[model samples]
Target: MSAESLERRTRNYLNNNVPQIQDHGGHFEVEDVDEETGEVTVAIGGACSGCGIAPMTMNAIKHRLPDEVSDISKVTVRQANGPRAAVMPNKTDEMEAMEEYQDYNPPF
Candidate 1:
């Protein structure tokens, strides 16, 4: 598939299967697609900066993205705010509530 098509497909997959990303004010950006190797790089940003579930989100992208998006053999996720953001000093009630669903695995 063309790079544009691949990116579009990836975005659609994220929207449909990983709605939490958008629901939480986060977003995924298709940074690059290696047509020759079937590899994709994505960046997760916005509220995801200090999200407690950011690691899970990245893991899902790495393991599940390929299964949903055609022509994608591997996925690399980049955190926009760097690794430090993964650990925040405080957690709000909403964030704590989200922890209850940490094991959530979206239906394919």
Candidate 2:
């Protein structure tokens, strides 16, 4: 349940799952896991940067991450490069934005 252990397991899982992605010129990098909130932050780069299916890929990754690592409750995928800046917003800031948006919007 430690952050280090979760990180190692996540990296191993990514290595196993992402070779084909890398072969396609896409890459996934495990950035950090917050033990306090059980959120895993990942960066997707290379061909995945501007991929049309990036949202689907992100959802797939989000669903898979927690299943693979019991300590993780959620996964956040960040585009390392796209229309957005190379440096992504902090996970906390992203979470806050999502929360604020959700407060004013109804669930689909």
Clashing pairs in 2: none
Q: Scored by CA lDDT, what does every candidate get?
A: 0.78, 0.70
Model 1 spans > 4 angstroms off: 82-108
Cα lDDT tens digits for candidate 1, 15-96: 7888888888887788898887889999988778777667667877899988877799999998786544555534443554
**Candidate 2 accuracy as TM-score:** 0.68
lDDT string, candidate 2, 1-108, tens digits: 788888888888877775655776888888888888888899888776655555556666777878877778888887786564334333433543575534432111
Off-target runs (Cα >4 Å) in candidate 2 are 82-108
**Candidate number achieving the greatest lDDT relative to the actual structure:** 1
lDDT of 1 at 52: 64
- Pairs with steric clashes in candidate 1: none
